[model samples]
Every structure is written in structure tokens, then in C-alpha cells.
Target: MLRDIDPILSPDLLHALRAMGHGDEIVIADANFPAEGLGPRCIRADGSSASDMLRAALSVLPLDTFVPDPAHSMAVVDDPDAIPEAVADFQRIIDDTADHPARIAPLERFAFYERAASAFAVIQTGERRLYGNIILKKGVIAP
Candidate 1:
């Protein structure tokens, strides 16, 4: 238990967040995500919802302001325009927690998987909702 830190953020997760540099990306993935096979390191957030994990991560990780879209979510198959309930929750959480105003850009299913595979790390959450996955780019803290 650290002071002011969300309990949901385990030690390993905190280490990953702290170790990431500006522009490095991390994925907060749903239960269905194949995090283990992804090239990057995987952290398990079992029993935690995607929204809960997102909120906890955003509490300390700053979103990259250099990029137009610092956050991303998987798009519903064949319906790029449709926002699933979990994706909507992700937007709300980002809106509430990010240092700057930002929205989660929708990524094609394969595109999203490719991005996740290249991320600095993947936090696999136990969220059962389809398409609850999200990716966040790390940003530098202003001096």
C-alpha cells in the first residue's frame, strides 16, 4: 500500500508505468485479448474490469500530448462507427482522468492487435465485455 496510490495498481504494474518513457504505449486489454502471445511483456490484472484498470493507470500515467490520439480502443467488427458499452466507458474514464482533453480513437480489429503486440507492455484485465481493450501512450511530466 503506497500513499495516495490506487490499490488496484499492483507493484508490477506500477513498475511498468514508471519504466515507460515518453511515447511508449501500454495496453489495457480485455479477458479475450491474447496478451501472452503479444511480443511485449504482459501483466495480469485478473478480477479487474477494463474501466477500473484504465482509471488506475491514468491516475499516474500521463497521456502523450505530442500525438493527436494518445488513446485507442478496438472498433466493433464491421462497424467502425459503433461504440460498444465498454468503449464508451473507456472514453468517459479518459475524459475524467487524462491531464489533457482526449478521446479514444477507434482502431480496426487487426490494427488494434498489431498495436497491442508492439506496446511496451500489456495489462490484461478480467473485463468480460467484448472490445473492452484500450491502449495508452506515455507522456513526459512537465518540469
Candidate 2:
């Protein structure tokens, strides 16, 4: 066990977060997400909620400040304005963890899937909520 590290963060997830460079993105996906067929490497966070997993990841991974939007979540299908309960949970976690208040931009299903495929890695959580998927871009640590 490492000092001060959230036990929810598996070793593989920690490695991926550490290996990612500034602006590299990582997706914290729901169980329904097509993570397996996506191109990016996938890490399983089975039995964990998406919000819990997101908090664990954000504990160590800094969000990119260079971009106007460093956080993203999948928008409800056919209802872009709809905010799923899970997405709200994700936003709460992001707001609490980020250096500044962060807004989680909503993306259409296909766009979200495409972005996930191009992310540095995907952490598939066991969260059963629809539209629970969220993407976070890594940022450099201040010197």
C-alpha cells in the first residue's frame, strides 16, 4: 500500500495516470460503454461506482487547465439537455477535486465514443447508470 493513495485506485490505473502527459485524456466509463472495442487501453474497475472511481482518479491526476473544457460527460441520447443523475454526481466530484470549479461539457453519444477511443486510457467502472461516462484531460503539475 502506498502512503496517502486512495485504495480505490488500482495499480494499473495509477500507472496509466502517471504515464499520461499533459493534455492526454482518460475516460471513466460506465458498464454499458463499449470500452472493449475502443482503441485505447482499458482498465477495469469492476464493483466500483463511476463517481467513486472518478474521485480516486482525480485524486492523483491533474486536469488540463490549458483547455477551455477539461472534463466531458456523455449527453443523454435524443436529449442533449438532459442531465442524468450520474452525470451530476460526476460533476460534483469534479468540482470538489479540481483546482478550480470545473464544468463537465456534454457530448453526444457518438462523439463521446470517438473521444474515448482516442483517450490515453479508459477506466471501465461497474456503475449501472446510463450516461455515466466522463473524460478527463491530464495536466502538468506546477513546478
Candidate 3:
């Protein structure tokens, strides 16, 4: 167990985060997310909640400042404006953890799936909440 690192972040997850370059994206998906079917490297964090996984990831991964929205979450079907509890938690985590003030924008259902499929990796969490999935773009660490 590495000091200062969240225990929930397994070795595989840490490797993926470290390997990602600026602009590369990673998905922290809910239990319902078809992580395996969507492709990309899938890392299972089945015992962790989406929020827990998000917080752990953000602790080390910097959000892309070049893009307006470095973080994104799946929108509720037919009610894109609605913020689910899990998504609210995500926003809170981002607000608290990000080096910059990053807000999580909502992505259309299919659009989110497409983005997740193209992500550098997907961390599938055991969060049971609907629409708990989030995508984070990696950013450069300033010298």
C-alpha cells in the first residue's frame, strides 16, 4: 500500500492513470455500465462506489484545463437537466478535488457511451445508482 494513495486504487488503476497522457480520457463507470462490451481497457473496482472512485482518481489525475469541460457525466434519459444524486456527488468531488474549478457537464446517453468506448480506460465501480458514470480528461502537470 503506497503512502498517500487511496487504497481503493488498485495497481492496475494506478498504472492506467500514470500511462494516460494529456487529453486522454478515462471513465469511472457505474455497475450498470457495459464496461466490458464497450471496449478499451477495463479495470474493475467492483467494491467501490463511483464517487469513491472519482475522488481517488482526481487525487492524482489533473483535469484538462484546455477544454471548457474536463469532466462529464451521463444525462438522465429524457431529462437531461436533472442531476441525479450520484452525479451531484460527482460534482462535489470534482469541486473539492480538482486543482482548478472543474464542473461536470452532462452528456447525452448514447454520446456518453460512445465517449466511454473511446476512453483510454474504464474503471467499472460497484455503484448501484443510475447515471453514476463520469468521464475525466487527463491534463498536463505543470513543471
Instruction: Provide the TM-score for each candidate, comma-separated.
Output: 0.98, 0.97, 0.98
lDDT by residue (1-143, candidate 3, tens digit) is 99999999999999999999999999999999999999899999999999999999989999999999999999999999999999999998888888885888999999999999999999999999999999999999999
Which residue ranges in model 2 land beyond 4 Å of their true spot? none
Best by lDDT: 3
Candidate 1 lDDT over 40-91, as tens digits, reads 9999999899999999999999999999999999999999999999999999
Runs with alpha carbons beyond 4 Å of true place in candidate 1 = none
| Candidate 2, position 45, lDDT | 92
lDDT of each: 0.94, 0.90, 0.95
Q: Residues 1-143, candidate 2: write the lDDT tens digits.
A: 89999998889989999999999999999998899999899999988999999888888888888899999999888899999999999888888987655799999889999898999999999999988899999988899
Which wins on lDDT, candidate 1 or candidate 3?
3
What TM-score does candidate 3 reach?
Answer: 0.98
lDDT for model 1, on a 0 to 1 scale? 0.94
In candidate 3, which residue pairs clash?
A: none
Error of 1 at 106 (Å): 0.7
